[model samples]
Target chain A: MTEADEENGPDSGHDEIRSLVKGAFRGQQEDRVDVLAGVQAKIYDRSGGKFFSDGWSTSRTPPISTYLVTSWVMLLILAALYCVLAPISGEPKRVPTYPAPVRVIPATQ
Target chain B: MMRGLSVTVTEADDERRFLRRLQARDEHAFNELVQLYEGRVYRLVLRILGKPDEAEDMAQDVFVAVFRSVDKFRGDSKLSTWIYKIAINLCKNRGRYWSRRPSEAAEDLGDVEEKGWLEEGPARTTAELSAPDQHVQGYQVEEIVRRCIQELGPDYRDVVVLRDVEELRYEEIVEITGLPEGTVKSRLHRGRALLKARVSRLLGEKIE
Candidate 1:
């Protein structure tokens, strides 16, 4: 170990590095591990290849025509929904207002 | 999308068996593969990225890429080497695209060391230092430890961190870095000297 340590260079600060590493390990930043696991999960979900699960290309369509047709159908459905639900009407809806004076009653005895 | 060819299970040797299963798109083998090197990959990425969240995302990206491209992984090298190549490439892209230069990286030495000493409240930062503390933190110490590492002319930094902090064997490092063994050893020696000088400066500051 000393030879290897000496080979690395002057032994001036070797102790510092050793202590720093020990401290860092003692910190045991599990958050780092969790974050890494999250990455694994994301990759696994995207490429893990479970039967009928999340992945890059879930449905492998054969041709451009199939994609085009699907696109058209989806567009039509979206257009229809927009037409029905959109606030395209020029006039705003009228909410009937009641007189405010009726609620302003005199202070109770 | 890469093909959905099923991974083949064979009664062959270890590498062959693993490779066969991986090539055939066996999710079980893939999971096992992930289990094997997830820690190393994550640690490598975290060291590069410095942020837990970003490292995690990058690590996953590396594995996902591996999963998709396993078919193309000719067993010309060790599986770990191949995986490291993919991981390093992914980390490089992430670091590049995210504009994460080593210059912008934070230094943890003082904070880590201080915490080790105090065993108390949150670590004190260089910014909040008193004049005495600032003087104690000499230019050479600052230059040698923090900036020297950051200024280590990118090539050295990667090799140094990979070899020292991550503790990869020389051959494994050479495989991943594509540097000659002699070059690797040379850089390690130089990098260690620089690091030692920096650490010495910090100690001197404390004594003063």
Candidate 2:
């Protein structure tokens, strides 16, 4: 036991128990069995062997179909907004353009 | 520092790859997962259940549940944490079932007594005993510690096992158990105190 263990009054036996527990569990291993095979068989049966291709993956990215549908929906919404705003706003008030000055009076006829 | 960062990145990538393979129903990835965690799961279940047969069954069940629900694993926590949660929950359910069945509970209790460690006389002085006798005494002490741990309440036992035996960090334990940190700390504190008192008595020492 260390001084620190002693200082913690209730921990006097902590080290002893910890060591004994570790020893008891150290050499312990699960009995040899093909757990993977068992699990795979179960999953296969549950999913009718379609699990390999059809089960959900952990990936969170949206599917291609979902992305395509979302993009189309957003485009439709933007088009609708433009239609609603265009007539109300009209075209930008056309700026009146001034013609360039002509110096035709310099002919000494 | 750079090496450590790279190691962390590699581990993260490996875990992501493993998850992908598991999701894809790759048998090899499943085998590797079992190889990596089966022993720890077995030991944790054994400590919780105190019966080898049941612990073995429980450990297998944990993996099955993990495989079934691999898609639900959102990477919110470490895979080990999720597995621990499954094991702990299964143990808790088994405990509850056992409690409702008096005959089985009695049998387990009887087994504890039949082990005869607690009934053994006071601890012999190690200095006075022969070498073989000293060894026997030590073994008895170990048995006593194991029994004492078994006798702790489920809440305390779970925290004690996770913290002391498994040596998980407080945050990880909280994630596995879904308990607040304060609750985990208090339970651990009380569990240690109780274990200390029991072991001290078993060893014929005065309790401070």
Candidate 3:
């Protein structure tokens, strides 16, 4: 036990070291400024817009395409599963597509 | 146990989906990733490289590598773990580059050091720095810690920073370093001892 302690390993209670280590994290939040813009700029320049084609790479805001693509894919998959399984469960006549909204033309307008 | 495992599997699936987005270069996914990891990468690089400006550039380089090659990520370990591996690897590479061109690296970084940083901070002595007025002396202690951490050999510094400073798990450290578990343990032990000796010397204490 004494030998291990002498080594000052993780088992040792060196709170001072731990406390001081926070120094690494200390600095202006400005110093720790967001690198996303820099990273995007680099990737865009390096790849010649192979990545920045849509300007999303340079945009700080999260791209809408991310959520849209995932939602659309998942929705399509679920709809397909429901449509395929509907027939197996004796519901083939059910349609997956929503009926188009009725165009109620104003009568004799 | 079963519930825990299902939760774990679900998390893995979620990560896989996220990884796919990153691989596909989904703009929002990439943005989210940079925001999520920029702080951590900055901290690790700052501690390793020993300068805020250099750390920022290094951190940027790390994310660039991550985005470019994210498709190659095999998911053998967690995505964050893979990112740490990249950060540490880049730090090592930059460290080597600096050492190879001492005149240039020193000239550039020395200027940063001279302009209101550790070597110029108040509280000259460790004892004075350790006084109860943390708010007053905090900067000095922080600078001292940074210098001491930088002073150690890279082998020792990496383990010390990852284990003591970052407080990562042994297994995770092992993954980041790709060092054997036993080697990690031994190096961590020796690193801590060396750090303690440095601190003791700073305090002008006699330690066997």
Give each candidate's interface RMSD in Å.
7.5, 6.7, 4.3
What's the lDDT for candidate 3?
0.75
Q: Note the residue pairs that clash in candidate 1.
A: B6-B24, B7-B24, B7-B25
What local lDDT does model 2 show for residue A21?
54
* Local accuracy of candidate 2 as per-residue lDDT tens digits, B1-208: 9999999989989899899988876755776788788878888888888777887778878888888888889878888999999999999998888878864542343454466554345443333346786657756665666667777888988998898778899899999999998778777777877876776766656334
In model 2, residue pairs whose N, Cα or C atoms come closer than 3 Å (at least 3 residues apart or on different chains), thus clashing, are: none
TM-score of each: 0.53, 0.66, 0.70
Q: On residues B53-86, what C-alpha lDDT tens digit does candidate 3 reach at each position? A: 8888899999999988898999999999999999
The alpha-carbon deviation from the true structure for residue B85 of candidate 2, after best TM-score superposition, in angstroms, is 1.4
Candidate 3 fraction of reference contacts recovered: 0.45
Tens digit per residue, CA lDDT, model 1, B1-208: 1233322222224787789998987656766777677777887666555566777777778877887788998887788888887887786676566565545456556664554433222222333345665534432233334344444544566666666566678788888888897777667666655655655444443310
Cα lDDT of all candidates, in order?
0.59, 0.72, 0.75
DockQ of each: 0.06, 0.10, 0.21
Backbone clash count for every predicted candidate, in the order shown: 3, 0, 0
Q: What does the TM-score come to for chain B in model 2? A: 0.86
The weakest ten consecutive residues by lDDT in model 2 chain B span B119-128
**Can you give the lDDT of residue B189 in candidate 1?**
61
**Which residue ranges in model 2 land beyond 4 Å of their true spot?**
A1-109, B105-130
Q: Return the lDDT, model 2, position B148.
A: 76
Q: Name the better of 2 and 3 by TM-score.
A: 3
